[model samples]
Target: MRILHKQQHLPPLDGPRLEPHPFRAAGMPPDKSNGAPLVPVNRREHGLEARRTDMAADQRGEGAAVNTEHKDGDRQPPHGAHDAFDFRQLGKEDFEQFEALLRYAFQVSSSEMARIGWSDREMKLSKKPIFEASHVMGWFYKGRLASQVVIYPMEVNVQGEICKMGGITGVATYPEYTGRGLIHSLLAKSLEYMRDQQQIISYLCPYSIPLYRKHGWEIVSDKMTFAIKDTQLPARHPVEGQIERVDIESEDLHKVYKYFALQEHGALIRGALEWEEYWRWDSDDVMAAVYYSVDRKPLGYVIYYIENEVFSIKEMVYLNQEAKYGIWNYISAHFSMITKVEGANYTGEAMAFQLEDSEIDETIQPYGMARIVDVQRFMEFYPFQFSDPRLTLDFEVKDPIAPWNNGIFHVSWQDGEAVCEQVATCHSGHRIALDIQTLTTMLMGYKRPTYLYNNDRIDMDYHLLKTLEALIPPDKPYFSDYF
Candidate 1:
């Protein structure tokens, strides 16, 4: 990897040439100040002594001035000189500083907190679980946290294969420190850490699509919201299974989701951390209903609540056609109790086409993005569809963040098996070209090879394009979880 010094003369890799988007928070400074209430640290990973020993080296060089590539254009440095700061992984001890940066960057107002039932007491109690579950790192100036990013060690089902994934969230920076390349350094270090830990893929919900695109992330999934009137609700479909309402933390709900996630591609396997995030903002009025077979086996569930004459569904998962009909049968029973039903679909397909009444209103928007952390490891585990004669292809990958992924990847498939390797140069004619983001989304089956080439996101010859289309399966990812 190349050092992150200013103006390093590294040759640019081959790929599409789009002008870089300036990294800025946009608009006026946040209304809140950097002073946040102190957070109580609990469940510390290491004792105070061991933590200090591990962080001592990172904190030793606080007084030295360091300059890296400013992702945006050159702006005048603060105080007529570059800021002297330290970069290190955050632990439980740094909770106060980390919380401050998040509040300042996101501008969490008192009114917003009250609406969501957030109080200072609850906020303080939330610190322990977050620190225990996430990997946090930040840039500090004079011992004060200025910028931060959090990575959740998680797993997701990718085309029936359980892949170790790094889920990135809570990224923030102070407005004054925007153009100093602080985020660039943090992102580079984050990618390197994910590679070493064997997290082959990474995903994030982007606040700015263009900003993350420059850093090697592309859209991989979408969220669809649909509304159906009481008259339009699916006509009750009879089934042997029956719906049973249960507690929000029912074990039956967990069992149903576990089976569904395992069988469904691109679904999140919820653990304790994911469950916490799932119900974090909901009120006590929310409840869950699970579909049980006549044989007493749980098959599907829906977490929902009725409010303001509207039946709102947070999530609904089903294992088979019986479960799907049984769950909807429960919702149809509520037709006399509510005016309409509103819910979201994470599967990249339209619900209108499936519903008996195809006139319901629906809208779709991009939800999450992903990037390949280690190209070699990702291709090795990837399940590419293979047929007759052997297929060989070589293409250059241009990754802006991780240098190890910025070389030519040579791949071949034969005898119902596929293998890949990265080399300094392509052995065959450069038949295709892609960036890390495009490759990730393409292989994940979110976007097909032909769509990418037609959209000018990939450069491929006529023959190579057809081969990729056949080699890749057609299954759009079904990701609905947020962080």
Candidate 2:
């Protein structure tokens, strides 16, 4: 069989597992498929429209930080570099201009809004939730909002350690304000704010990989889309758990995920604010089936829908192998109803190995990007396998956006805990030098030090390489949600 891999533009998470409907308050219209009935499955909004749907994300809650960080010689003169620009956090009063710029940047047309059953009144109501939940910052010239960034306070599980993660979204600048370093300052400010909030790490769905990389972000997760015929479905695996269809916003749904997120490495902690981000463009008719053990404990759940003879799996997560089998059994039971099954696997691994027939179609592509917002703080809490006596590792990180990360970060163990302190000079000790991009991916467990070393992305000796290999846990991050 011949295989072809391709890239497409997409769509926007963090929190306690919020039971509230995701983005229901963000003027999410009713079941009006906006006169476009064939709903896009899982970030289908980007696939439905033009490529690089990240611009559309600019309309929502992704964007951040301020001016202290000077990227690696990337400081460009603003329209009036010497002129004073008001860089501040946005409030409810600034909602109108904020909405205007977002709609303009994302190209959300009047007709599109009307088709989706949205009104000026409904649009106005959404401001409350957005303002309360997001740290929307902007640069205003002549009292007009031109460039902006919004960061959501969120958390993530990295090898079982919960780290506050800043979700950067909705970054945009008017053409007239281009190359003035408005974004540079705004992003710097956002990063500063994140640091204040103790958000050591940051995540964003990239509109351009190289563009974000210039700022220190790197690919941390991937989306693997698979298509399987009814004949290829695995024969139902016998299980003790029972599956039952429930409301789309079922508590069991969120609770199961809450348990899953808390334990799973690299999972997003979804609170109320994050829930809103999850269902931003989803239909209300969506359904969920939860898998409960014989004793009635939720172990897993599957959110899905059926349309046009296709069983689309919006999301399927299980806490254990049994739950995985039980969920698959539910999907196989629909064999007579669906001609094919389609879903995305975000584990950066092939699903064929687990299936009865391994000939199904699968596609893997880069999904999300992240970076160490505050390198010192991130390492301070990072769960590195401690070495004998005391574990110590130094990182000569080069951050292009946040200047604070560009230097030698001396990380060592103290009292059985990891401690990170920046040093002016690299001493004669075990040292591994790399940029912020490589460091972020390595620490996140996406790529190993040896892999990056072989790829020539790391500067390290053979002994230090082996030390890093053992210190870092081995596993790619699992992130299926798009924010």
Tens digits of lDDT, candidate 1, 1-483: 211111113243232121222421122221132222123334222112342343333223211111212134322234534348788899888987777776666666667667778886676566558766789998888888877888889888776677788988778777666656666567778899999878888988777665566677789999999999999998888899789999988988988877777656688889987988878767778989999888878888899999999999988988777888999999989978999999989988899988888999999999989998999888767766654333567867777668899888887655554567887777766357777878989998899987887666676554455567666767788888886
Tens digit of per-residue lDDT, candidate 2, span 381-448? 77666534345667887666677888898876667566678998877376677777889999998888
Q: What TM-score goes with each of the models? A: 0.82, 0.82
Stretches of candidate 1 off by over 4 Å are: 1-83, 387-389, 414-416
Task: Report per-prediction Cα RMSD to one decimal.
Answer: 17.1, 14.9
lDDT of 2: 0.72
Among all windows of 10 consecutive residues in model 1, the one with the lowest summed lDDT is 61-70
